[model samples]
Target: MKYRYFLILFTFFTILGACNQPISQTSKASAKKVINAAPEKKIPIDTSKAFKFNDNWVVPKSSLDFNSLGDSQGDTLKLAVCGDFVYSPFGTIKDSSAFSSSLLKNFSIVTRTEKMDNGTFNFQILNHGSSKLIFFFDTDPEASRHSDIFKGEIYDEDVQFVNGIRIGMSFPNFYKTLFDSFPDDLTNNYTVVQIISCVDDIIQTYDFDAGKLKSVKFITDSYWKVDY
Candidate 1:
């Protein structure tokens, strides 16, 4: 009888120990999971609104003199110049008048007109060489009213900008020539003036893609303040 009793006690204790072992292992596993768990991420707060502006924000005057830069070698590559044709900010043409009799002889020209809601007309000229030109003219019947060339685009491989910058030129080379010729002080200035000698009165901007010259533009000074 005592032997059977001792056997029963041993069996009970063994079962209890096995249960305790699992509890201990479970606790250890839970602790490891807690230790290895990743922390929560915190979102950053924007504090720009708290910053204040001071007089130091004023932009300094540019040191470079842009007036001295001359036009490109070929007359066609010059600002407002195309194949045997030249357009000046001061020069004007009457409605439906030919661009140039001399240029018409050498190149086929396609012209289109779009009347805007305002009393103005938008004229687009496409030359045989794929050069595109735009002109804006007031609709007044006054003889003094003439069309003014506002923009032009050149895609010809042979043509280049005043500083030898071309359509396919690498961005680094173009930027070097641009900054070297123009002042680096474009901090707060709205307009880049005098990009070429003949185009001093007009403001210009350059566009690039993947470090390559994409296009050049002549825009109004107020264009900089446009919201997009």
Candidate 2:
């Protein structure tokens, strides 16, 4: 009878020990699933700072329109202009002049001519004293028959695009701010990313070198280089 009682006591202790054991693998997995099933909270995007600037820079607004001058009427025309500069097929032009004496007064202008198969093409480069900024102008009225020729590089911090892009800005932040996506690694050569406007006729190119913006090109797709 004592042996029987002892056996019952031993069985009771064994069951209690089993109850104290760690949870099963299946129970752990179920708990993990329950935790993972909870909805994740998302951060709201700030519309005010999304694509806006306080400066005088203007963002191009697109409107429904077709390229009237192009061969295909269905092709959309995207022309980007920043401040006083207008983009064309050849280059960017400022103040609607290939060589503006009023604007060039502050800077030294160097003019040169290139002999082409059909004719001679004129080119001009404007340089400021001790400034790294340079502007290249196409002076050939016949070569750029559609628009004036002007291309420039901006190294000033005071100058900022409408989307808050500026020289020396980090590539990741610029990419995230402009595109809202993570940027890929850029090589030594400048990585060119073109921004096309849907609502307006505007196409802008941002060139990044060494993880910073090197230059910006505003292009008008409607214009093409005049065959010499």
Candidate 3:
């Protein structure tokens, strides 16, 4: 009887040990639960208030003496009511002054128009980055290039002002010449201009060196419409 009791006790412990062995199922399930838990981004619901604006930066009387850095009154762009910052998206693969100018030349293809009701208007920003431009249109979709506006936005991939500020500067008339080179119909009621130049505002300045952006200034307190 003593032998049998010892045998039974040993068998019970062996079974208990087998049952207690660490199982792989529980650990894997716990790990998966932890791995799958993550949050998602929330986009805005209301962006119904959007409208487009024109630019009014004028050109110097003499194209030969025009200075991109200063001495540019660029008036036609102002008449269009633009004259601020704009956004441009790009990649690090392509960059240079002539290439950037070629990219700017293509900005005319990016045109968006929506019917408005009185003063109700709004616009939205697309993917952000440096690779695009904004020029004013001379309202004349027909006269090759109207005195109204002549502009578009595109990336230059060629010009860099240090710390990844790749861009090119142009007077309103420079855009006018580009627009005039085309043979499209321009009208007076709704014009086009190439004076729209901004990265995040109607102003021509950008401040990404900081956390948030700071807009550029043209004539005192004049700034582009802020959407954010």
- What's the TM-score of every candidate structure? 0.33, 0.38, 0.24
What is the per-residue lDDT of model 2 for residues 10-89, given as tens digits with 9 covering 90 to 100? 99999999999999999999999999999999555444423232221212222211121121112122222232222332
Q: Residue 228 in model 2: shift from native, Å?
A: 26
Give the TM-score comparing model 3 with the true structure, all chains together.
0.24
Evaluation by TM-score, superior candidate among 1 and 3:
1
Of models 1 and 3, which has the larger lDDT?
A: 1
Query: Candidate 1: which pairs clash?
Result: 171-211
User: Which has the greatest lDDT?
Assistant: 2
Tell how far residue 45 is off in model 2, in angstroms. Answer: 16
Q: Indicate the TM-score of model 1.
A: 0.33
Q: What is the full ranking by lDDT, best candidate first?
A: 2, 1, 3
lDDT of 1 by residue, 164-227 (tens): 6566676546546533322224222321223432333343445555545566554432121211
Task: For residues 1-228, write the lDDT of model 3, one tens digit per residue.
Answer: 999999999999999999998878988899988888866674432222212223322232221122132222432222222121122222221222222354233322333443344333222222124333323222334633111111123233343321233333332222343222211222221221322332212323221212222222222122333222
Looking at model 2, the pairs that clash are 61-200, 62-199, 62-200, 63-199, 79-201, 92-150
Question: Comparing 1 and 2 by TM-score, which wins?
Answer: 2
Candidates' lDDT values, in order? 0.42, 0.46, 0.31
Residue 43, candidate 2: alpha-carbon lDDT: 58
Residue range with the least summed lDDT across 10 consecutive positions in model 1: 76-85
